[model samples]
Target chain A: MIQRKKSLQCRHVDAGSCNACEQELTALLSKELDIQHYGIDIVASPRHADALLVTGPVTDTMQPALKKVWEAVPKPRQLIAVGDCAAGCGVFQKAYASHGGVDKVLEKPDQTILGCPPDPEKILDTLRELMNS
Target chain B: MSEASRVENPYNEWINDNISHKKAGDVWLALTGYRDGQIKSHWLRANGRIDEVKTACMDAQFASLTPSLPEVAWDEREIHDLFGYHPKGHPDLRPLVRTPRWPASFYPMQKQSDDHIEWTDVEPDNPAKVVEGEGITIMKVGPTHAGIIESGHFVFSIIGENILHLDAHLFQNHRGVEKALESLSVQEAKPLISRICGADTVSHQYNFLSAVEQLAGRKVPEMIEWQRIILLESERILSHLNDLAQIPAGVGFTVAHQRGLAMKEMWQKGLSAIFGHRFLFDAMYQEKLAVSKKEQLQQLLASFITQWHKWRKLADRQQGFHDRMRGVGVVKRDDAEQLGAVGVALRAAGVSVDVRTLMPLYRHNRIHIPQVTGGDVEARFQVRLQEVEHSIALIRNALEHLQGNQQDTSWSIPDDLTGEAVSYSESPHGLNAHVMQIQNGVILRYHVKSGAYRNWPVLAFAVAGNAVADFPLINKSFELCYSCADR
Candidate 1:
């Protein structure tokens, strides 16, 4: 079990992902997972976000846009990388069009959720753990 | 049977005179065939594959076919971008995947290599052509949406609240998967192909493997084929549920959204418990399911239908929900047919182009394709709801037939495979076609035209004359996947 605090607000960015992870993320919004109840909310803007949630691998096309997004969040911002693609570039890594993983553009993430898309429960658990920490 | 088939040159005329005259069905496939300093147009007929062997030259010049077949407009532009074979009279041939930073001389898919590529610093200009007038205002949205969804750029030309025009620019996340699949074997490419669209993993894998199987002249055992159908229906059921759930989400109808998602979660949980993954990424790769486990899964699904009916009734009773969706985002039958819409969009437009019914495969002959006319947001939702019910019935039927069935489910590949084959399957979105060109067991070219790719054009048409406030509801009805379309 982890510590509890104010709800963490997150901004999600799809950097050349297959969108499998996005499905799991959407499921988190559903009543069953209900991440909002657990004090983790998905924010629309990076300025309001406490952390940046990244999915898929960083692509050459999205790299500049991603960097711009990362810069938008205020200081003391946490970066969380979700899914296999964002962690180590997964299947799309080393492709000419992709830099592979969020680290390529944003350096190492504060927390990384693994899986082709980490299950919704796992995502909640990790957030819970991060809250306690 | 082993020889490469050819259509005729001047494909525009051939299509106008011969193929269009047939009117048997719609244009299923359009791809550029690259040979020794020659470009060809390959169109898959309803009956079989037809290749226009010498349609154009290698130099940046070719007669545009988009004038006749508006659907292939995107394909022609993509061909031009990748191979430097320009379609001379294409109306809008701006870079589909390539940004301004990409050097004009560097065409990635060409035989010659300009291997070293870098990110460009060019300021992004609005590629979407906007209408200029006193009241017309261009509103740009996305490449990053408000929710957890894939990226796409939408340029809407609006006068006050009414949308005059909408131009969507996708492929922002194009990972160059086709280039990655260059020398990979059929088995080696399966993972990449399936991942092309995560929600449509099973369908993509099935279509790709079916194409390879056709090329190899191998038949899947009857029972395994039946099991494959179940896998596909399982994918269909869950995917439709997700899309349907979004409908209520778009309108802020939380109760309906929650109910829909509850059913979706219930279904996905059962899928994960029975199969290894929730999405069944490689479940088909397994030889066979244990008989007892199969029975258990069937029982679980049987109970799920009861819950689905109850939840569906509650969702159906929401009057406010129907008000928002009823007449929003209407894509008329003419526009849908002309744009070559597929899946739900096409079905909602009252065209019975369901691949299962049109070209019955495996045990799909036993299934009925449910369609809803009116081409509005409500029609698409109703179509999806009906499809979920149909998929549930299909799964149950397949399970019932598999009671005493025992068949070899071994997945194998032939040693020597050298041919080109095209396979099309109806994904939850629409027709997902995979075109593969193989030589000496290595994949030379791999191209996919997913349902999202075909139906994306319809969105622009649907949003026109609609209010800007209804854009989310309208867009939700189509449920277009930017990654799938981009890929």
Candidate 2:
């Protein structure tokens, strides 16, 4: 794992998720979780992101866009795949329109969090580990 | 024309004319309509019913229904793009699901086209139609927006601060879910259906399962029916709360936005504790709800209602929040009905067209259909607020019925299940319908027409004549899901 500073600025890319992952990711911003308190923030632009948080099965239409976003992220960036779909396409495997996961389109993800949609706590835990790394 | 079969119209009061054409084995083009509290589905082939026309032949040409129905315009365009069917005289027949990256010769929905093919990086030519004038300035926004939202392209023709016309381009995230479902078994397709849109999981799963149950000729017990109602209402409350929070966020009302999100978090956590998943992914198949868990749910809801009323009172006091939302993004009743608006949007426009009214499950209960006249952002907001309260009542009533019932919720699928059926469920967004064909327990064809698909065009209609700066606010008010539409 690449060592990161005290703060982790992540950019989320919805490559073709069903939005379940996005829902959980949004939940991370809730007052109960408040992922920002852990020194993790979801940045608006990929340029300022220390990590690229991806979700989805990486459909053919989104493959190029995902690559572009990954390239736009600065060096020493960690690529984190959230949800089973991003890790290995889950139910969408062998889909004609999908590349079947983020790894098939981009380089291997630095970390993969598993679940149909990993719970907010699980995602926050991974982010915290990245922060401490 | 003489060979076309005309089935008996059980709903003659609503459907006066019914026409259908057989387009190969077991597949036919049919029409569905609603009138006078009755929804009629005219099945032309076997036992299958389709809300709109379904032409399955390769390179088939059919008369465009958009000129008459107007609601099926998007359905036709989608049929053309995915199924290689040509709708003659269809207005604005641009690509609906297929983006520019997809090859023109390739139609993904065709059975023969199922094999994997190399995708080309070359951008294909597909242009947006915009109004041209001497001083008109066109503004284009996202297939990828600045916020944490789904992909949708909006082309606006603006003069000064007012929007003249808005052309929305969506389906950039189409993952061929319908095509993918074809190869899976009936039971295997549940996971994909549940994920069609995470927030609408229970609604989608319910619709799909209803269709499957109909195919198998299985009747769910009364206790299980009550369980289903509880699950559906819980999902409705969650969805409404999220939208309630989002609308305020659109208007920059931080207090209500944050408070609403917090309330929503509490509800999600409560659901997670009771049901395994936060979004209730496969909660439909859950066997039983213990009495203790039910009590815990009631306690959570009681506190939530208290918090909700306090937040509403505080938010209503803010005149600025109301000012930004009152007259903005007004969708008239005539336009809403003509364009086939559903869920809160339709009800807000004073149209009583909820699918739940047609279902026996809700009809057995005192389901309230909330209506407002303005059809603006504030009207939609008010409708959603009313619905959250109604949903809570619905859950409580279902729980009351389930107080002593401890029956197994699981139902077995028949081994010889084979047929096609159409089922509709009132998803939080609106009416979600699924048409599925099963051949000996395997899914042959599956088509989903979500409320988002029907309401997307209406959203574009709502945005016109509004100030350019208020676009986000208007968009948030509708809060349609792009993932479901794309799928």
**Can you tell me which runs of candidate 1 are displaced by over 4 Å?**
A1-4, B1-24, B33-54, B111-114, B124-126, B290-292, B403-411
- In Å, residue A30's CA in model 2 sits off its true spot by 2.4
Q: What is the lDDT, from 0 to 100, of the residue A37 in candidate 1?
A: 88
The residue pairs that clash in candidate 2, if any, are none
How much DockQ does model 2 earn?
Answer: 0.63
lDDT of 1 by residue, A1-133 (tens): 2223666788899988888889888888888889998889899999988788899788777777788889999877789999999998488776667778999788899999999878999988887777656
Best by TM-score: 1
> What digit string (tens of lDDT, one per residue) describes model 1 on residues B1-487?
0122223343445335424522555454545546343444444455544433345453657766676668877887888777788776689898787777666676778743426676567744437779999978999987776679887778899998999999888888887887777788877887788788888888888888888988988767666676778888899998898888888888898877888888888888898888778888877766476344677777778788898888788778877788878889998888898888989998898987777654345444465666578899999998998898888777777776665546454546875789988787888888888778899899888788788888888888899999999988898898888777776
What are the per-model DockQ values?
A: 0.67, 0.63
The digit string of per-residue lDDT tens for model 2 on B53-167 reads: 3232223665555654567778778877876777665887988777777866788766554666757786422488798998999998766555567766789999999999998
Evaluated at residue B357, the lDDT of candidate 2 is: 66
